[model samples]
Target: MSASAAGPDWGIFEGRTLSLLHPASMLGMAALSVSTALLGFQWRRQRTIGGEINELKAQLPNLNGAKTVSEALAAAQSAEMVDTSYV
Candidate 1:
């Protein structure tokens, strides 16, 4: 098929000129604006999430070692046995 018969070619920044009111230029400007806004939003969200993760890390107690399930159960039982008056 001929180039004209294919379809309307939507080239990025095509037919741009000094004037800012061109259709193609307006479309390009709009696209850039949308992408910049989206990127800024994503950056702020990630920064907020990073701050929250740091706060959570600071609130958590230090871990000594990993314990088996049975060992954890025994510890819980010992503690419970000593504090049966509260139950």
Candidate 2:
């Protein structure tokens, strides 16, 4: 279509500005998308690990206030019929 009726077709920012901007804008958008995706992946990974840790905490029983490994084992071996807690 001819722009004769539009009068002179003078666009803002003259000489290849729009053309140069297109590629630069596209590159910037690509970088933004990639960084956002990586951030999302990191968040998802942390959430998954956090959930797994929570599940483990829920499933396992607490050590009956024993500070050391030897003490814990000793407590488990003692007190008959206590189900034998592991360290």
Candidate 3:
């Protein structure tokens, strides 16, 4: 059967499909899907940020146990600065 004749439906998997009968349910499912995708993105981003922080800490031993990326960078730069002194 043609798709339009069967009405609007969502294909969940390769062969399986969810017949969209109620508009409210469809809306709810769509909202849920979007939120879940956004959550996944945030989780991945958090992991990447954490990895970066760990790498920076390993590379710069003078980081002073900084938790965030900005703080780690600042500490690294400051640690590299040479103090000027004249006698």
Candidate 4:
């Protein structure tokens, strides 16, 4: 049988229909929709952050190598530092 034909009389759902029409139900539905949207936005933001972190991690080796070279040069110039006393 079709859904409409198998169901109880329409009047049986009158109270439920009225309840659905109430403002609180509408507000609840709106809140649920907004919450779902916000959750999706937060998930997208987290994914973007993760992607950026991975990109930065991939660049770390080059950065570390450059820093090592700079430190080595500074260490070689330590004799210049020895001539300048804070005292």
Query: What TM-score against the true fold does each predicted structure earn?
Result: 0.42, 0.49, 0.39, 0.43
Clashing pairs in 3: none
Query: What C-alpha RMSD separates each model from the true structure?
Result: 11.2, 8.0, 12.4, 8.7
Runs in model 2 deviating more than 4 A are 1-12, 54-70, 73-87
1 against 4, candidate with superior TM-score: 4
Candidate scoring better on TM-score of 1 and 3 = 1
For candidate 2, write residues 1-87 as lDDT tens digits.
965646535575444776688899999999999999999999999879988998897986667898876888888888655554662
Clash statistics: count for each candidate: 0, 0, 0, 0
**TM-score quality measure for candidate 1:** 0.42
Candidate No. with top lDDT: 2
lDDT of each: 0.70, 0.80, 0.74, 0.74
- Superpose all Cα atoms of candidate 2 onto the true structure and report the RMSD in Å to 1 decimal: 8.0
lDDT of 1 by residue, 14-63 (tens): 33443345776789999999999999999999879988999998996543
Q: Model 3 compared with the native: what TM-score?
A: 0.39
User: What lDDT is obtained when candidate 4 is compared to the true structure?
Assistant: 0.74
Tell me the TM-score of model 4: 0.43
- What's the lDDT of the predicted structure labeled candidate 2? 0.80
Model 3 bad stretches (over 4 Å): 1-21, 55-87
- On TM-score, the stronger of 3 and 4 is 4
